[model samples]
Target chain A: MVSIAEHTPAPGRAGGGRLAWAFVERQTNLWKRYWAWELVWLMYGVVNTLAITFIAKQVGNEGAASSINVSKLILFLLIGTLVWAYLSAVLDDISLVVTWERWEGTIEHTLMAPVPRALHLIGMSVFGVLHAVVRTLLIFAIAVPFFSIDFGGANWLTAAVVLAAGSFSIAGLAILAGVLPLLYPERGAQMSFMVQALVLLVSGVYYQVSVLPGWLQVFSYVSPATYILDGIRGGIIDGKSVADTWRTLAALGVFGTVLIPLGIVTFMVAEQWAKKTGKLKRQG
Target chain B: MLDELPLRAAGVAKTFGGGFDYGRLLPWRRDGHAPEPPRRVVDDVSFEIRRREIFGVIGANGSGKSTLIRIISTLLLPDAGEVRIFGLDVVRDTMRVRALINRVSADPSFFRNMNALENLLFFGKVYGLSGRDVREQSPRVLARLGLDWEQALEPMSHLSRGQQQKVAVARALLTSPVLMLLDEPTTGLDPRSKRDVQSFVREVREEHDATILLTTHDMEEAELLCDRIAFLSGGRIVAEGTPVELRRTIAAGRPLDEITMETVFMELTGRSVEEDEEPREVLAHG
Candidate 1:
């Protein structure tokens, strides 16, 4: 056997990209183990989108449906539900970062390693984005034929760009919410879900933001999901080009630019405080 | 030389509980509103480890040995005082200090779903090891700790407690840390596995020139592996010296062979090693 001394890595920092990919790999391995749960969530999303979007068809078939365009309403509901699915998936994945560590009982070991905090978090965010994308695409594929929607005029490329652009801001917000579990292990997971619920209510996942009361509109302005939902609806349901949706794209870019750094700094502060308070160890 | 000391801790302290909480004032107090005092888990502890020395801290469960190790390893910040690794302050030079240190504690956590090879490879990457290096080297380290290479390919959750402990040991050694902190690394291992880990620790120091600070409750294991041992009671070091020196100090002219490390510990702490733990619930009738 080779002496451990001979194989010791030289003292230095791990590559940021390699460490990030390792975290992504870790999540992928976890997905492989619990794929049944993943499929269950996928099935639940498909059922949910179908159930909600069919409301439009029911309304159109009503006796007072003289002015209802069943196809347009179905498209509207489909885009709303699908966009909500994608947005919520990203939020849940990012916010559960700390919860996942605690459940696995690996919080102490992972935090004690020599890697920088930013690299660790960014890696997790990268995984969250990729995982959410794959899961959302699967749901979309399953719902497409079931809904019987025509793909004739929808600007698919533009919708994809909008979804991608909105993801960064969602990642930032999720990172911020992830700090709750680190700070208050007992109620932190619930608190993170509450934050997600707030984003959902204010982001117009099922209705237009203008329909919200004036005070609630402030939250919608702050939520990147509002812009995301609007941009996605315009691209897919209204068949708008990227040039037409550039305002929402730019708004998302601005939110990402601001929130990512803010989230990182805030999470770091909370993490340092947790360490001083001895909260890094898994609490019963 | 002190300049090259692998570990130095001065007046390190960590207290648990006693922070202000509204819940404590919720009429559950025991008569007359007396609040619970903060328990100092690591109380004004001070120590230094010279380069390549294997230092042992012997204590019963809950004697603060693990807390002291955590403070030195930069896992938890000390409430007061400071720790330095290779003369770099643990708090201010945390990243550099972390690069120099690695720790193996009791019940070392891993990605249980992944095989030992996968877990080690992830940690190896965290320690900056290349993929090829981790794949080639981790198996050899596992074999040295008496874990079969084939068995290491199974999920860590499937391994025995002792086998998992060996994997933990192997993980720490994979980084070739300049200062290795073993907080009860073999506490729950079987005898054979214990000996495997013990001999592995010895070989690591000899071959890698790694300095080790080991905390354990096993008296014979301490005497066998530690160049010097410190007996801790109630979060304080009651005695510290070479094993033989500690035995002879209180031997009172008795035969040296008759005075064992257990006796030395009993003499210093006023309790047997088995009874050294601080009882949690004090019996009281009010």
Candidate 2:
């Protein structure tokens, strides 16, 4: 029999595009196998949204209904819950970049491969964004019917633009949080949830940032999710055009532009530290 | 270019467990206490490998064989020294160096849910192999290692340890890397699987334009496969030569055929390679 090594080609250099697409493809294959988990999360999001949005509908009084602006109240809760759901999903996916590999016992093999660090992450971020969008859209599809939502005046195109821009910053924050697991294997995974929780509270997932204490308002300004929630609400509820929410959109763009690179660099540094400290192989 | 000598290590050193005072965490700790001394894992070690040569590093557990392999594979950096692969510095040209090498660790990792073919294809793509090439090459490689093509479709979690190891070897070979780092490639294999892997290693050295740096504590395996062997004890290369040359180190004018590798190891390290008779306590140093 002919030897397999005879047909083997010389080792080739990894281009960022090909490697990134490979990562995307790998993630897609994984999702195909475990799509039930995604459906479960989608159902959970729908139930969570309905439970929160119905708070305004529960008060059975004309005076309370008029004072509450029940329609706007539901919209607020809808946007708040949906945006929070999307942002958290993206964060969770990207942050698990290392954790998933660790869980699968493939961290060393994957990390030691010849692919560029940026492409590896960009590919994962691409999958995260795509996965988050699909689940969020499904939740939205199942959700709008529960309420008499009026999309006739809603600027959905602007909302999508805001979501796209805002996703980059969330991607950056998730990459930063992902380094926590690489750095502190024992407690890092849980600590990442704390970071997400802080963002949830400060970004006004359920209430306006104005309602937060004076000190926390500073964090709200720093969190790109705040602008995402604001811009998305403006587009979907007020029917504001892209120009009307350009400032928030632009802020998100700037956040994505800066944080992505910053997050990558921070993660790389932490990775080096982990390897040096023999923490790379740590599994829980 | 950069193909004459496949591997070279110059005064490589790595240390662990120093820097901060962990003892101070105790409730009865006092001030002005110094931290524990750093333990050197790979202590000023250096060696070189020629192209297409199978060089083996033999040592007991915790002798820093894996650490040395990691340093050479560019997975871990040397604290104080240089490692060059094919005339390229492992640190300076890490990406290029990585492209030229592939490693098969003792316990290989893979996507458990994915079949062998899927894992191999994924790894192949990461190493810049085309999908078609991966598909064509994976089966043949697995067959050479005593694994059937049909069995390669099963999820890795369902496969036996030996079969998974064969898949790991297949994945490493799929890329046709210039240098192959095998960290105890046949450490826990059955006799047949061990012989299968050993035969594949010989075949790779003969057919592929590759240099093999293997680490193992198995004396017979090293003798049969490696062109030269280095006995690493306590993170240092205490003996280095071909099997015959190593045997002659303590031959004492006796016939060379009477000297076994075990005798050489016993005379050099004053301990049997077998684990049953050894003490259970592990020292801090590598």
Candidate 3:
């Protein structure tokens, strides 16, 4: 017989808060607990930078077209690689938080909070991208001395715009990825794998979009990373002015409008499905 | 009688299905076959939890006690009936309803790698509590739950299950949430920790004007802490009343003071939670 006098410790808002600064504080605290993850990320960045430098050298030696300027190409490739990392980092965190809640049975807490579920995902992605941005900046600081590379045209304004647009797109995709974790939770790796596949093949990561055949080129157009990488490359490497990169921003903004609504709707529907299916109740 | 009920539910039903149907085609599914008829997890559960009263809910495993809590918390939408929290429709005014309540489950997952302060601070922020308020009130809640402030910075994993559970209580109290849905809060605690928590809950209600809905299978917990209890069996409330009223009703000839809820549960359901003595450990897995 359980006695009220003898009983002990006890614990939901499924995402209910608005996109509040206070909510972001909740996310920031979560990020702090996993410091070892940051060190691992630093190692990943170093290995990744080395891998791109090696690959760019190979492309130069093999006489691949698109101008085999070794130093510039390596730097450009590294920049492109870092951008991909930044975007995926945001998406990864968003999806993983959903997965984490499912695994730990903590989603109920978030669901019960007085915030929208989308705000939680958006808040998570924003912080994740902020972490990635800071990490990329650190990598640049380290690379500048070791690799003896220039920071390209010092137009902080264009860099800022590109970064802003890039983060917005990644934030959008992060919500999309976050939705998949809620929808197809059993298919754990599938959500992240698809996000990575979209980044690696469709975006100009290892290869440029123009290099692809026409059929594959269509996919590149749809990828947010393609516009993001192209804009970054134009502004930083090619030293192209704002007029030249307007198309990239316009494309990204359009993608943002479509994805933002679609992502939110999909998430709401997926959560509704979860409620309808009693998945949240069952799991919690 | 129910004019100002904090929570009210009537004929609330929930069904589960659409599982693995993409591969195995549902016959009536919009995309394919609907597969099989969905099994009802929560079936026609009707009850009202009045404001500022501690309502105890007792049920066997798989009897939908947790599901009922989730539906009340607005984490779930019932298929058939309505739920209103603080006179607001749960479905139509979900955002407001959420603000009025917070649930604490059996195995509450605080950030495992974080310290007690960190998890509480994080949750305080989630409820839109100011940093100043969290900074001021967090230690107070922890202290009220018998947590040691000097050891507040230790990683949660290092804390005993009881201590961690205390932290969970502190976190829920951050909002001073009016309606607290506690699901088997003391399931794994040592006896002393259990006593501390139960007493703390009484204090919360007596001092803060809070209404509580606690789910448990412990007969003593229902008798001692709950003002009224509803015996749940197979997703239905078999019986409900004040502690004394319930005992008298269950055993008509027996003196109320001599009656036990375990006896009531046995008489009504033809089964008892104590019979399942396999001791379900609240295992902590990532």
Candidate 4:
């Protein structure tokens, strides 16, 4: 048959435009089969919104309000949960994709492609974020009336940018976790669990960073997760004037820029090391 | 069709790192990612593939066949080597290497949920194939592969293994690359699919003016396809020449009909290797 993957005409292939379009297309295809992940995240978003609303109600006793008070407790909880949910895979599943590919005996195939190795991993992360966004949108559509939220015009597009940048930064951490297997295959599974635990305990997913001890708080601030949460919280829930969130948005942007490049570079170095050491076949 | 050389690697040597050095022919001694060991995968390996030349890399597993192909395709760097495609260094000029080469490994991954056409469209954009051109051209490619046009819309998971392998080959062929790296492209195929893929390679070389670098463990495949054969053992070339010349070198005493590759292999290495035997373990190497 005629070749399916012929190099299309160029001028388009130069610079970020082509690569970004490639990634965006790949992510869309990836999300076609992501209904299960979508379902789980939707339920999780609901569960989190409900759980936080109850917790805040208890903090108020006979009607005491949150430190960050809001008349609609459910809306506040839902907004935070929906936005931060993008961090789940980064907080945990980065290594799992490799482990998953290794177990399936497919990573070798991925490596064989002429495309750079980092693109596939980053593509997976971008796809995961896209999947998360769909579920978050679904939850918003369903829960809007139940929570009686006035999500009207309080800077929704800015909220999306801040959340996306934050999540991508965390995905960089996830990508780093993913490359550990290529470098240290046997340690891969263990490291996956350890990273997930760290994200859970230290990233302040369930509680504020201040809740952790001082040293742990310092570590959390260093986490890409912290910037993600800070950006999302600052943009969506806080929804203060843009001037109020300038610092948080900037921090998220800086982390976003650094995270992807750092992760890809680490992946490249580890891949070079693995091939040299015959680790590809062993791990596969 | 290709009057000029498309890919060239001169004095190419790939070394294993860490613990084991597999190069027995070009032995050196050193450490820390340096080139002081003899377990060179492509020991001083030099060759030039002209455009449209179906150059094949044939050797036993661990004989550095795949390693050599990978290096040419810019997947791995050589320890003491230089690979240039139209004067572009595979190392210093990686983006160029990628643009010039389209590699189809033994296996390829596709989205399980998407049909063959969907996967093509996805990768089409990756190669910068976009818009109506991608949508219209996908089915034409699929049809050429003998896939039913309707199958383009079916989920990939429902397809047979042989069919999926075809998709992998199709993805590589889709790009019409200047240099094609086929690493055991037919390793898992049935005899028929194997022939189909082999024939496709031959066709592409003829029609597209592409240069092909293929690696395989099957001697029959090598004898049937490769223009020049290199007997690689222990990560170095023990012998390399045209099949007739190689057979003649070993046929000095034996009849031509009896001078199969097995005899030639045994004559050089003093060990008879068979495709059936699980081959040597990859041996943890540095």
DockQ, per-model, please?
0.47, 0.44, 0.35, 0.27
Q: Which candidate comes out best when scored by lDDT?
A: 2
How well does candidate 4 score on lDDT at residue A172? Answer: 78
Give the docking tier of candidate 3.
acceptable
Candidate 2, backbone clash total: 0
Please give the lDDT score at residue B52 for candidate 2: 82
Model 1 regions more than 4 Å off = A1-13, A63-68, B1-3, B22-36, B279-286
Clashing pairs in 1: none
Ranking by DockQ: 1, 2, 3, 4
**Candidate 4, fnat value?**
0.22
Counted clashes in each candidate structure? 0, 0, 37, 22
> Please, what is the whole-model Cα lDDT of each candidate in the order they appear?
0.84, 0.84, 0.74, 0.66
Model 3, residue A64: displacement in angstroms?
7.1
Q: List the residue pairs that clash in candidate 2.
A: none
Give a tens-digit lDDT track for model 1, residues A1-284: 33333433344646678877778888888888788999899999999999998887788778445433677778878888888788778888888888898888888788877778888888888888898889888888888787667768889888989989999899899999999998898999999999999998999887778899999999999999999888888888789999999999999999999888888898889988887878888662
lDDT comparing candidate 1 with the true structure: 0.84
- What are the TM-scores, per candidate, against the unseen true structure? 0.93, 0.92, 0.89, 0.79
Worst 10 residues of 1 chain B by lDDT: B277-286
Interface RMSD of each: 4.6, 4.7, 8.3, 6.2
CA lDDT of B259 in candidate 3?
Answer: 73
